[model samples]
Target: MALLSHDAGGKPVRAASGANATLYCNESTAGLSMLHKELAQLDERVQRLIAAYRQARLERKRALQERDRLLALNAELKRRIEGVVERIRLLESDQAQ
Candidate 1:
């Protein structure tokens, strides 16, 4: 059993659930439509942001892989330099002898 009431314009408005509450046709309907539109726009914006975030994550992953590869190459180069220095020291010691 829904109760019916009238707005200020004397138009019979449907009342919401509860006692003595009248729904303003213009305000409620228009506001809801506007809110729905804004929500849809916000949803689309969120989807785009999510896609961008995923792309950034993929880029970050590739960058990390490249960094790891470079670090390994640096370590290998450092080891070779150390070996060359040891060989030079050994040769100089032999010459001194």
Candidate 2:
């Protein structure tokens, strides 16, 4: 007798295939049912954790991209400000001549 049976979605459950099937008591069946429930719950939690990890990875990538953009922008602004300050110094020197 096969020790397992599958549902439509191919999930396995303990089963007895032959005449001795009724030998399993209600308590054992209940225990098996509880174990299956706990396993399913764990599976769900693991999936949720995996999804959260992926989201965090994407957020990190986005943050890095934003940081690169801001760094470039800051460099450009500093260069422009320095040029403006040099021009002001040159103008002030020329005015004093």
Candidate 3:
């Protein structure tokens, strides 16, 4: 059931659900033709915010991928350096003998 009544001036009043609640119209409509315009503006703002959030999520994923790649490269370089050091140590031992 809709909770509504008309004031003496013929303006619609929100009743029942609200305590002597009065507006030009329903709470959702908020009265008049202004409601449509306001709803459109609010929708546009929400869409823009959602798009920004999606772009940020994509950038974060790409950054994580790059970090993993660099870490792998560092590990490979460490292995190669350690191998070279071991060879140098063996050469010194042979020379000393």
Best candidate (score: TM-score): 2
RMSD after Cα superposition, model 1? 7.5
**Number of the candidate with higher TM-score, 1 or 3:** 1
> How well is each residue in 38-67 modelled by candidate 2, as lDDT tens digits?
999999999999999999999999999999
Clashing pairs for predicted structure model 1, backbone only: none
Provide TM-scores for the models. Answer: 0.67, 0.74, 0.64
**Tens digits of lDDT, candidate 1, 1-97:** 3434456799866655544343454466777799899999999999999999999999999999999999999999999999999999999999999
lDDT tens digits, residues 5-70, model 3?
Answer: 566699875555444343433454455358688889999999999999999999999999999999
Per lDDT, the best of the predicted structures is 2
Model 1: residues with Cα > 4 Å off, grouped in runs: 1-26
Select the stronger candidate by lDDT from 1 and 2.
2
Global local distance difference test of model 3: 0.78
Q: What does each candidate score in C-alpha RMSD?
A: 7.5, 5.7, 8.0
| Residue 75 accuracy (lDDT) in model 1 | 100
Candidate 3 deviant stretches above 4 angstroms: 1-31
Q: Pick out the ten consecutive residues of candidate 3 with the lowest summed lDDT.
A: 17-26
**lDDT-best of 1 and 3:** 1
